[model samples]
Target chain A: MAKGPNVNWLPVKDDNRPVNLDLTKFHFPLPAITSILHRISGVLIFVGTAVLMWLLAESLSSEEGFQRVGEWLQSPIVKFIVWGILSGLLYHLIAGLRHLLMDAGIGETLEGGRRGAVLIIVFSVISILIAGVWVW
Target chain B: MVSRVSGATNLGRNGLHDWVLQRFSAIVLAIYTLGLLGWFAVNPDFSYGAWRGLFDATWMKIATLAAIIALCAHAWIGMWTIATDYLTSLALGKAATFVRLLFQAGCVILIFTYLVWGVQILWGL
Candidate 1:
């Protein structure tokens, strides 16, 4: 919270005129931030899918290939990228669950939704940290 | 409001259909992910032999195939939703529709390739 971006994405006055609408000057609410983060994590995992597919295909190709994959996991940079993708997957999974819950009529209120968003942040950080440990 | 101009191009030509498919595919994907995590936990130091054995099973192959299909469907809907949400006339001006369709066509081809490639990888196992 020390240094934050400065922008209001879609601020409008009572008359529906633009208040700021500057991308950099956006003031993000917790809910909005969480929602955007969900979108971001989904896109990240989507882009990383090709790498994942390649890894799967290679690892299953032969004994030598499988051993190579295991060894690749030992590399620090490979481990980092794996962890990043895992983090994105886990975040998307968690946020997607929240969306499902909302669709099912749970936490549908403004206040309840805020609480859900807060819970998502807490859970995602803890889960991502745990996944990091597991990956490394 | 979300745009409906591109609705006809959506999967099944129905928002509810896309919505249901998205959620269904999501559940399948989540289950598949959790299943992998469970396998990892059980294997601890899973060797190449053990890993191959896991996928070599008929059940596991079926599960993997199902997961890949769900992944493609889930991704298609998600990408389409993102495009319609942002790649619009309101944001991208007059050429938005053209640009969006081009982007979407790319997505479709990529997803289809993933689907075919995934099936090949799995069944060839």
Candidate 2:
């Protein structure tokens, strides 16, 4: 009988263990943090799309409709919403591009992924700032 | 049963397909977003007439439609993936899958409505 570690032939079973991970105490890596933020930004953009579609539909209806949207956008609250949505969009866009590049065999390594995450954060901040200035 | 296992594996394959389509749609959306933003940035005097004229071009209308479709596709896959990852039997038990399916259905309805609305707007009907 072969009694070596490499020679043991045991059937692997499905891991049905209960997950007890304490998310609050868990320390996520930078890349993981970026990934979670990407999901969140996606949700934000999803919700914001309704508001944008409404604005678009209204603006395209008539000249008065367009004026109404333009005036509404001038309000501080509306401007704030626009800024928030644009910020979410900008972050999501950058992170999404990172994911695409990863799929294309770029940033496939651990160090490369980390660098990409950092670049996404930096680019998103600058873009959001520009969007804020444009909206305000 | 072996058939059941194969069925589950097929679902996994479909997920891979969804992943590919999601990225493809994302690329389309990114291009459209950049172009639209650039147009707005250069045209400081954005009025109703300017907005109308921009969409008045056939190419612009087609591009906008394509972007709208891609946006819907991307959002559907994204939201579906999120729901599947977070909302599961381990989390919400029996209610989890039901809620996830409901949310997905709602997204589908919303996407369909947006597509119809987009077509109407683009064709000026």
Candidate 3:
């Protein structure tokens, strides 16, 4: 390792002049968008798992337990929550598959990543529609 | 690195496993979701015996079980990849590995619990 001072540890203001800091000039790229969405979907899955597990435990306890869960599903508010969870599951599944594909060297190129993002959107919409039908 | 032609397919390296598993799970979940919707549409009462009868069918039992298993496996693989990729520090990486092990174990327990429940319903246990 170099014995010189670490440039990365320096404050941004020390490294660059205030006049040069033009935030408006910067724009988010496609890859950044996709990456952000991936993290979002991951969080969604984490939250959804908690809710789904509760439903599973309740439904399996007894016949009345099953009925209670079934009744919750019938309510519009509960249905909305279920639909939201399903949507999260659906998007996370698709985006995750994309990341796996990328890791396997499938979508490493710029064009490939763009296409993968498009595919994610398409899959998400289709799954959401299915959830809508199931819920409503 | 020299690429040799051993010809034994590297399914994991080529992402075939991920692709196939993901789509396979998706298909299972799709069918399961649709069937559950139908159950609600046709028999909304959701009585004790009615719920039992639904899961008692050979196809429903198999399908639901399969869906649960596939969903868990698919989610496990996905989460493991994310945790490994992001947590860069060696210590954090090891922590993530431990977490992944817990995740896989938990998923197995989940599937086992569901299977036991389903069997008890079918076999009067």
Candidate 4:
């Protein structure tokens, strides 16, 4: 029989003491950063979906409704908002695909996960730039 | 030494289901988004007629409805996870958890309303 490494098992201690820690001083790794941004992007997309649904409903209602949405899209502020929404969508989509790939066991290793995160950021930035040009 | 309980309840048993649904919805939304963007790119002059014509197709209407449903599912799970993970507060007792549940429920109602409204708009009914 093959020998295995020894393990140490410790008994649990009852401790309800409060521990103060500063989150601002913490350093986030690439994968952690990507994961947090994915959550943030999901929230952004959720809010943006509301706005998009409203626009779709308005545009599909009648000719006047369509014209109203068309006119609204012509404003610079509206365009900016659209750009922001698109950027969020792009990043979310890319990072989300990475997550899916990870789920499929493609990037399960630490090194692979880091590389995937970097690729997500790079690709998303390029896509967002393209979306900005298209929107404006 | 503290006594350890072997049969402690698992908090994350249902999380796996939500995780799978989120990923599934994400795939659907991604395809719909890319397809919509491609349609827009190919047809630069997006007039009212063009918009109406696109949605008038039965297939397009069905796809759009599916996408909307997927979006709702995806958003609900995402928001629910975020709320549960970040809304805990020791000082506020269970207030944070209560508020988180309320917000999630509100979001579900809003999303369902939008989904119904979107379908009506798509079919012009």
Between candidates 1 and 3, the one scoring higher on DockQ is 1
- For A1-136, candidate 4 gives per-residue lDDT tens digits of 3332221122333433443333455688988888899899888878887788888888887889999988998999999988998999999999988888888899899899889989998999999999999987
lDDT of 1 by residue, A1-136 (tens): 2322232233442343334544567788899999998888888898888889988999999999998888999999999998999999988999999999999999999998999999999999999999899988
The TM-score of candidate 2's chain A against the true chain A comes to: 0.84
> Which TM-score does chain B of candidate 3 obtain?
0.61
Q: lDDT at A133 for candidate 3?
A: 87
Model 2 has a DockQ score of: 0.44
Model 4 per-residue lDDT tens digits across residues B29-116: 9999999999999999688888988899999999999898888878777776676666544323446556766777788788788788
Candidate 2 residue runs with Cα over 4 Å from true position: A1-19, B1-13
Per-model DockQ against the true two-chain complex: 0.38, 0.44, 0.11, 0.47
Q: What lDDT tens digits, residue by residue, belong to model 3 across residues B16-76?
A: 6766776677567656766776777788545777766766678876776787666665565
Candidate 2: tens digits of C-alpha lDDT, residues A12-113:
434344434446667899899999999999999888988888888899889999999989989999999989999999999999988888989998998998
Ranking by TM-score: 1, 2, 4, 3
Best by DockQ: 4
User: How does candidate 3 fare on TM-score?
Assistant: 0.54
Report the C-alpha lDDT of model 3 over A1-136, residue by residue, as the tens digit: 2233323323353443334223346587766666677666655665465577678657766877888898898899989988888787677667766776776799889899888888888888997897798778
Best-to-worst DockQ order:
4, 2, 1, 3
Summarize candidate 1's per-residue lDDT along B68-102 as a digit string, tens digits. 89998998898888888888665777777888989
Q: How far is candidate 4 from the true structure (C-alpha RMSD, Å)?
A: 7.6
Query: Which regions of candidate 1 fall more than 4 Å away from where they truly are?
Result: A1-25, B1-5
Global lDDT scores for all candidate models: 0.85, 0.82, 0.63, 0.78
